[model samples]
Target: MFGVTILGNNSAIPTLDRYPTAQIVTCNDQLLLIDCGEGTQLQIAKYRIKRGKLRYIFISHLHGDHYFGLIGLLNTLNLMGRVDPLSIYAPPELEQIIQIQMECSGTALRYEINFVPLMPGYTGVILEDKDLSVSCFPTQHRISCFGFSVELRKKKRKLIPDQAKAYEVPAAYYGKLQEGADYLRKDGLLVKNDWVTIPPEKGKRYVYCADTIYDVNLLPYLQDADVIYHETTYLHELEGRAAERFHSTSVQAASLAAAAHAKRLLIGHFSSMYTELDPFLEQTRPIFPNTDIAEEGVTFLV
Candidate 1:
């Protein structure tokens, strides 16, 4: 169930056919909402996502298109009588913006929100739980922006059944062995945990490069990702315009993914002026054949 569901792929404006930038990453039972643009709640409803499982929100920047619907979503969760605590990771100014909105409207949330502010020029691990690890890096945008790297780690150690049985270990205690606990024998002998158990399986990594200009420095974060989502706001022909607007072109995004050796690339945040999205794929796929369009409501497994 580790996958990313695109809610709104369009950038800036919400056209009749597309909304703005929003996505939901499903990490096992938990859900992470990234970049709550306008109409995100409706899109969530349309997709029938389990809002109750949503535990975290990650905003890339303060642009209206990136976070205009955040306050609304928080309020909706409050009105829905949510009691679970929610954690948010974003720029430092987001706290003030949320506080002002809550104050002006006289709204008190039913659930607790823990906001972790991301400071300028910071690039390091922000979260590490039992089953997940998350880090953030600065992206080249018009304002202070960030890209998130979310990883789902395997928890249980790999057990060697043959070795365990050769040591006369019972199957009843296999679960404890998988939890990395030493086994005590009836004759006062001991079996070390690592002697019969191997390391856990490889983790699944997903990186979201939220709105950035063509920059090679991001390769460190994007390297070897199971899925890398990069914004392709324009075609290669509009390279100059994309640079002026601090956005990326289709070719640039694909080139970065190829250079980083990411397993797959999801390109979105398309400009509203473009009626057709085929050109984006046509230009990007030639460079990176494993690229996807990041279509709305479509989930890509990582």
Candidate 2:
């Protein structure tokens, strides 16, 4: 159930065939929308995503392509009569911008919206819910940009059914046993928690390098990720332009994925000039064989 769905993958401009930048990360039952570029609402509808499941939004930077659709999406949520609280994580200025837009239109949302700012040069854990934890780190971009690392944790203890059955433990109490509770027999014998269950397994992680230049400092943030989405805004031949613009080339993205030892790499945020996406994959696969295009309308499991 934990995966990422690409909505838009183009950078700087929106073309008929490509979009700006947007992604939906499904963390179990909850959905986190990242970088709501223009046409994001239409993309969501085209992909048939369950909008009601969306609970959080994360914007990497203030670039128009990264957050232009935010206000529209928020308005749509209000139009849908949503009452659940929505939390947004973004740079400090985004809150004021959203508020101003709302006020200018004399619009009020039906649901409560909370804003959590990612301060400049800040890095560390920013969110922790019952099943997931999210951390943010600065990326080398034109503006004050940040990347997100999401870890989905399993809290329940692993149940050993055989051990429980051997101890004459009833199935009715299995749920409690998984919660690390001790069992007491009718004869007053105590069944220790460890005798029938083990701690939950380690969680899996998905790291999103929203938009960054070819900077190796990001390796620490992407280390050992289950899946990583890094921007490859240009082909290897355009490395100079990419560096000058504070965007990454295909080779750079793959190199980072290889260095981080990530299970797989999803590259996108392509420049509008490149009508063909094959070059991006061709350049990255040679460096990191697991690299794949972050194709819109597709979901990648972490």
Candidate 3:
């Protein structure tokens, strides 16, 4: 149930076939919007994503391609009579920006909006809920951009059904057993939680590199990530151009994934200049074999 669904994968421009940068990170029942590029709400509808599950919105930077659709999405949620509180994490300026829009339009939202400002060069855990934790780190982009790392925590322990049954533990109480609670028998004997269950396996991690130039310092945030979404705005031939724009090339993205030892790499944020996407994979696979294009509407399991 933990995965990322791409809403928009293109950079800057919204092409007829592709869109700007946006993604939905699904952590169990909760959904987090990673970016709200133009056409994001339509893409969410087009993909039939459960908008009601969206609890948080994260903006990497003020770049139009990264957050232009945020206001529209928020307004739509209000029009739909959504009363659930929504939390937004982004740069400090975004709060004022959203406030200005709401004031100018004389719009009052039906739901509560919590704005958490991310200061420049900030690197730390931003959110921790019952099911997931999210951390943000700085990225080398044209503006003050950030990359996010999401870890879906394993809360329940692994239960040994045979052992539990042998201990005369009722099946109805297995849920509590998996939660590390000791079982009390009818005869007053206590069965240790560890006797029937083991600690849960380590959690899986998904890292989103957002928009960045080739920088090795990012390895700390990406190390041992189960999946990483890194922007490949250009092919290897356009590496110079990518650097000039503070965007990354295919080869550079692959190199970062390889350096981080990520299990898989998802590359997107492609420049509109390239009509076809095969070259990106072709160039990346040699450097990191476990690389795939972050195609819109595709859900990548973390």
Candidate 4:
């Protein structure tokens, strides 16, 4: 299963009901944390997310709202006897920030933390496994920031059972055939893997646009994404204010998703001033019919 669970959706100033930016991308049993805001660990527990499966953490920027809870989470994981090494993808400055906090507190982690720096203006694949791939690209924000693109893909080709049976390929060798291996029988028959299988469909993509102002340059990454998550920190009436803060309005986010032809649009990073979220949907739905509020604890399957 490939899905994103919203942990915290509010912007910098967290409200009573909403929190700062944080999300969990679940790919099968593995979990990737997109951002760690204040009280993220508590939210994780509230949502019943499996902390043991969390393998990677991606911080969009150095903003306190995005990563202030990181050290606390690390401490809790260590106390809970977590031994697996974790990887963090973030700006280079975060490495020092984490180190300084750990140093001052005399806290030495039992597990190793592999830090992969996402330098300014850098964009490329950061992590790839058999079932998932992740990449990061720059986003226009108040500071140096990045947006992540997560793709869930199958490594094996699609298997055609009828063709395999007609070729006299044993059922036991179906797995190997799907792995693109040809087979030779004792009767001197060569069965090409392509004869029984075809290439798998393109991977499903979920692009998180992080914190950014209205920028058309992001269309390449958002193009035809299964789901695109963009920040709508303000309503359409406050477009000028959003631009001043380097944030996007509800309409702007929907417009980009419509232009990119994204299948679904998830808008969050809402301002704390507004209590009700319906207005945001009301503003975006007309521009892009398929839009959803990034409600806390709700999982959006890709």
Candidate 5:
């Protein structure tokens, strides 16, 4: 089960009903947090999500709306006596900021915390564990921002039941066949692995374009993604303003999705000036019919 759950979707300011940017990506048994905006812990509780299951956190940039809640969340976790080690992947400056904050408060966390710094203007794979892989790429934000791509790989080969039975392969050997192992019969005949299994299916990918202007350079990272989350900070009417702020409009997000042929597009990071969200879908759907608003507390299956 690979999917992303939106916790906070608002842009800069936080309204009574809306929040800043934050999301949780569930890859099989592991949980990875994309951004930790303010009040993220409350949002987690609101959704009944298992916060303890979280193992990794990725911060896109130094924007306050993107990571203001990180320290608060860490404090709460330490207070709750969490002993499991946690790792955070973020820009190099974030480590010093976090360390200074912890130092001033004289707070010593019980669990080990590992900080992996992402250099400015750098884009490449950062982590790969089991079937889960995460990579970061540059985004066109005012700061040295990044976008993340999370992919879940299919490592096991597909078992062909008809071929396996035709080869007189025992049911007990099916597991080995899925693992791409040939079977040896008692009579000295060999049952080829290809006769019983096919190659693994393609991986599923979810790309989070944190904050960026309408730029085609992002297409390489977004190509053929199963699900994509792109910020739509304004309507097309404010396209110039969006460009000035280095943000994207709903129409731009839709166009990129159409270009990349992504399975689905999710639009969020809405500006506070807009009270209604229907216009976002109205503009995006005309270009990419599968576009959906990244509503808070909603989970999109990738």
Candidate 6:
């Protein structure tokens, strides 16, 4: 279930059909919300994303389109009587902003909110739990913004059923064998785990380049990622406007993905001026054939 669900893909303003920038990264059973833009909660409901499964939220910057829905989402969770704790990783100033909102409304959340501040120019692994690990890197945005790379670790060894049976190992012990544990026979003979198992396969990776200008420095973080989400706020014709606004054009996003050798590229965060999104793909696919518009409610498997 390693995939990304696009909740809102539009930029700054919320249009009649398009919302803002928000997405859900589904890593197995865990769900991570990336950038709670305006109308995020409604999008979640429309998409039928299990809200209780959401464990973490990552905000790219302090931009209104990126995190304006945080307070609303939190309030909704509290109103629903949710008691599970939630974690948020964002710029340091967001903590104060959220605190002020909570104070003004006198709303005491039922669940614990753990706010992890992402300082300026910070880049490192921020979380590691079970089979999931997430790292953050600085991006070239108007404000201090960051991109996230989520990796799903593969820990279990591949078991050879034929070899295990050759050693007369019981079927009940196969689980232990996959954990790299030696199997002991009834006669006290040990069957080495390596004889029946191979090393685990490499894990899958997903990179989210949240709201940033076209920059080649991001290649290192996006290298060989199974799926990458890069903002394409405008078409190629508006390349100048994109650069002036610290946003990316369709061609720029595809170029970055091609340079990084990413398996798939998901482009979104389209400007409000564009009513139809077909031109984005028409322009980007020529540069990077794997590029796809990050359509709202569509989940792209990583």
lDDT value, candidate 5, whole model: 0.94
lDDT of 3 by residue, 1-302 (tens): 99999999999988999999999999999999999999899999999999999999999999999999999999999998899999999999999999999999999999999999999989999999996999999999988999999999999999999999999999999999989999999899999999999999899999999999999999999999999999999999988999999999999999999999999999999999989999999999999999999999999999
Q: For candidate 2, what is the TM-score?
A: 0.95
Q: Report the lDDT tens digits of candidate 6 across residue range 166-240.
A: 999999999999889998889998999999999889999999999999999999999999999999999999889
Pairs of residues clashing in candidate 6: none
Model 5 agreement with the true structure over 1-302: per-residue lDDT tens digits: 89999999999998888899999999989999999999998898899888888999999999999999999999998998899999999999999998999999999999988999988888999999999999999998999999999999998999989989988999988998888899999899899898789999999999999999999999999999999999999999999999999999999999999999999999999999989999999999989999999999999999
Point out where model 2 deviates above 4 Å.
Answer: none
Tell how far residue 258 is off in model 3, in angstroms.
1.8
Q: Per-residue error at 108 for model 6, in Å?
A: 1.3
The candidate that wins on lDDT is: 3
Runs of candidate 6 exceeding 4 Å displacement: none
For the record, the alpha-carbon RMSD of candidate 1 to the native fold, in angstroms, is 1.1
Listed per candidate, the RMSD to the true structure in angstroms reads 1.1, 1.5, 1.8, 1.1, 1.2, 1.4
Candidate 1 colliding pairs: none
- Against the hidden true structure, what lDDT does model 2 obtain? 0.94
Query: What is the C-alpha local distance difference test score of each model?
Result: 0.94, 0.94, 0.95, 0.95, 0.94, 0.94
Model 3 segments more than 4 A misplaced = 160-172, 185-189
lDDT of 4 by residue, 1-302 (tens): 99999999999999999989999999988999999999999999999999999999999999899999898999899899999999999999999998998899998888899999998999999999777999999999999999999999977899999999999999999999988999897899999989999988788999999999999999999999999999999999999999999999999999999999999999999999889999999999999999999999999999
- Cα misplacement distance, residue 215 of candidate 1 (Å): 1.0
Identify the superior model by TM-score, candidate 3 or candidate 5: 5
Q: Residue 14 CA error for candidate 2 (Å)?
A: 1.0
